[model samples]
Target: MSLIGKEIGEFKVQSFVNNEFKEVTKEGVLGKWAVFFFYPADFTFVCPTELEDLADKYEDFKKIGCEIYSVSCDTHFVHKAWHDVSKTIKKIQYPMLADPTGTLARDFDVMIEENGLAERGSFIINPEGKIVAYEVIAGNVGRNADELFRRVQASQFVAEHGDEVCPAKWKPGAETLKPSLNLVGLL
Candidate 1:
């Protein structure tokens, strides 16, 4: 039941962006890549740092045609309130999704029932709405936005060059392995 390689464009979600509520779903992600990040809640310690990091890298993500959405179980009102109070949150230009029902978090399989919050999960979905990559970390750990950027670049490279596959620690302009019988055991 792993969501890997599965398409998730069918699920509709409400996201708070720039102090407004809007619908973001498969259709909204039709023409660009998406980074769907799930944090536990608003006004939390580690969450704010992670979110601020993502905000700092927002322009870079946008340059790659990716839309970022940070989701939590809190309502849009709560998100707005936090944005108003926190200078770190006020710098965020991307959408903050309200998953009060936990439906979206459940769909992404990041919801924790005991704590009633989401795990630190991140999904990199392609423009076609297929989930290309995903990572779920423990609640206490913060995610690396730079690594997320690298992953997106690698995925895009692989998609564009169908015959090549990126190796570990592959960055843009790095060598990619071609899948062939002759290449087996060559490395």
Candidate 2:
């Protein structure tokens, strides 16, 4: 079953952040937007670039009351080591969650059992812990943080303004369409 619209905030997850272990559950995400990004592992190509990109845009996400969490199958110690050694990873202020047991990855349905790693998956969960948007990409392709920011903006916009919906390639301040039977043939 697709996890779309499913509430996943109840699941308690143990992850490492800033050299300390912590549990992240519904309470952690309460009253704020959460972005959970699952990647393969640490000390690999593509993942660092993607993470660095997100780090570069961290302020933008923070401004919107969103917290970013990057997850992988590696242990939290590994995450911290990578953060210490890799120049790119050092800039990431967001939490790097360790899913060594693959529980969180499996819950997100992005675990690759054969390799015991996570696939490229991104989930945007609202304050209520309901998943609002999700993206799963092939292992070879890295994601764009700018696009993710735009999606967050659009999602927030629609949440505040119930009558409008973002259209394809929607950007902030762009016109959104109001779904209606009368507009069925208009497109």
Candidate 3:
């Protein structure tokens, strides 16, 4: 089943941030927007690039009241090790979540049971803790933070203006379509 519009469940896990281990929890994120970014594992190919890309745009997300969380089955130690070794990862200011037991992977339905790894998944959760949007991609393909940022803006716009719908390639200032009987057969 699709996770869109579904409320997030309670969870707490260790995370690496600012050269220290911290605990991140669903409860703590309540009333705040969050981006849960799930990847296969740490110290692997492609993951760092994706993370660094997100890191570069993290301030934009933060400006929009969204906290980015990069999750993997790797432990907090592994996350720290990767951050220490990878110059790209070292630039990250977001939390590096550790999902060693695959609880998060299972919850997000991104677990690769056979390999004990997770597929690439990205979820945008609103302030109410409900998932507003999500995307799951193949392991080989990476995601774009700019696109995701735009999606977050769209979601927020729609939430504030329930009568309007964002059109293709919608940006913050773009015009929105209002559903009406008069427009039924127009577009």
lDDT of each: 0.90, 0.88, 0.92
From the highest lDDT down, the ranking of the candidates is 3, 1, 2
Model 1: ten consecutive residues of lowest lDDT: 7-16
Taking the candidates one at a time, how many backbone clashes does each contain?
Answer: 0, 0, 0
Residue pairs in steric clash, candidate 2?
A: none
Per-residue lDDT of model 3, residues 91-174, tens digit only: 999999999999998998899999999999999999999998899999999899999999988998998997788998999998
Q: Pick the candidate with the highest TM-score.
A: 3
Between 1 and 3, whose TM-score is larger? 3
Candidates ranked by TM-score: 3, 1, 2
User: Which regions of candidate 1 deviate over 4 angstroms?
Assistant: 182-187
Candidate 1, residue 80: the lDDT equals 89
Model 2 lDDT vs. the true structure?
0.88
Better of 1 and 2 by TM-score: 1
